[model samples]
Target: MVTSATQVLFPERIYQCEANIQLIAAHPEQGCYVVTDRTPFHPVSHIWPDHPADRGTVVLESQVHEVVDCLVGAVEQESGQLYVGADIPVKRDEPGWVFVVVHHLAESIESSVGTKATLNVDEQYQLALSRGHSGGHLSSLALNKVLHHDFWRKDASRKDELGHYDFHSYAQTESRVTEDCSTDTYRIGKTLRKRGLNAADMIAALPTIADQINQQLAAWCEAGFPVDMRREGEALTDSRYWRCDLQEGVVVEIPCGGTHVTSLAEYAALRVEFQLINEQELVMITHSQPA
Candidate 1:
């Protein structure tokens, strides 16, 4: 069983580190699972599972082992049982469970528990995903501002970083990030309408709405806004926030547990497009290029 929460370094921009091997075991279907005292690898969150895991390699006993995948794992306090990814039964931070970052190795290493493992993440791949994640957040905020006044009622309670109605967060159904791109789907069904999103009007003005979001994105990129991931602690289960310093002293903070570039300046340009999948489904796709 895990003695404590794994010390996570990805939240603060760490991508490589030497860590002590806590446990090593072969899974029935997932190959070998390696648990470390600490890691820089960002695992796919079992709860959200939006951003993908960091792909990299682990070096031990002078041998290089490819990390095929990284995933969130938990060890039961009483049973000492380990659960990985989709097999995890309980919610995060559930009582009597210790959370861990599980590194799936293509092959088992010669070293066992108590050995030291040097972890190295694919920097280029990580950077691309960072750009996509940051762009996704900016695009969502811009979309919120563009639709706030037109569709949402004044009584709408939720607001985004720019103080517009936070329609993105409220109606968001699914989100996924890839290399320099992100696609988010939102459902504007009865609940959203009750919250004041005029479905028919929004559909009619889709083109204009897309223009507004793109313009907002252009301005933000030109300003070279700085982005950061603020964490309450270094533990794997600790809370983290994505903060971006925008124009007019506005700071946008959204609860997040994903990696992002240190600055929007990393993006040479950013933009988003809108699509209506059906009468009640809206999809926003964001694309970014690195500077």
Candidate 2:
């Protein structure tokens, strides 16, 4: 019988583990196999898939199988049956759910249930993602500050760490991080207006708003604030926070599980552009510079 081990490394950091290769089963139709246990590979979260999976190779003996994707797998606590990715029926951390990382192997190998294997990650790609994610967080805070004036009439309902109304939390529909940039989509529908957001006025002055956001981003980048992740514990399920020490005594902290750059100094420049997709939606595109 297979034993489930509690994860040791914090989800925000990359780790290396030597684990047994067990049950590499083909997906019947997806043309891939899922390798179980002991990986440094970070799987794309089923609950929040803002960051993509880490790509690398799984090595055993003299052969190597390229891991094209890494995804979250869950099993029933009582039944011990495994389900991959979106196939999971329950939310993560739900009572009685055991979460695992499913590494997608390119082809079948000769490894057995007890064979030891090594997992290697592409650090270059991981670092690029870290920079993009860090920049993305900062950009969102800047956008919130730039648009704070539009909600002057709302009773102070919620506030971000930077003292702006938490529009990013309520308006955001989807957020994606890429190697060089991050894209965030926000909904400005009836609910937002009901909360006293001037959607029409904001959309009309999008270019000016974008400029203000870019200015804030530039100032933060120039300040070279320290950035890092704070975790409750060194476990996959532990709560993590992305903490940033900005200028003017403003420190922004957001609950986040994704990896990020060590410092804002790594980014020489950051820029953001805005678009009005419809009467009730806005999209922000953010780009970052190299270390």
User: Which residue window of length 10 is worst by lDDT in model 2?
Assistant: 3-12
Candidate 2 lDDT over residue span 190-235, tens digit each: 9888887877888888888888888888888877888877878654
User: Which runs of model 1 end up more than 4 angstroms from their true locations?
Assistant: none
**Model 1 vs. true fold: TM:** 0.95
Error of 2 at 175 (Å): 1.3
What is the RMSD of candidate 2?
A: 2.4
Backbone collision tally, model 1: 0
Listed per model in order, the count of residue pairs whose N, CA or C atoms clash below 3 Å is 0, 0
Question: Best by TM-score, which number?
Answer: 1
TM-score of each: 0.95, 0.89
Q: Write the per-residue lDDT of candidate 1 for residues 1-291, one digit (tens) a residue.
A: 345678999877888999999877786775699999899899998888889999999999888899999999988878767788889898777999989999999976667678888999998898899899988999998888888777866568887778888888899999999999999999989988898888889889989988888998898898887888888988888899999878745778999898898987898889888888998898999999999
Write down the TM-score for model 2. Answer: 0.89
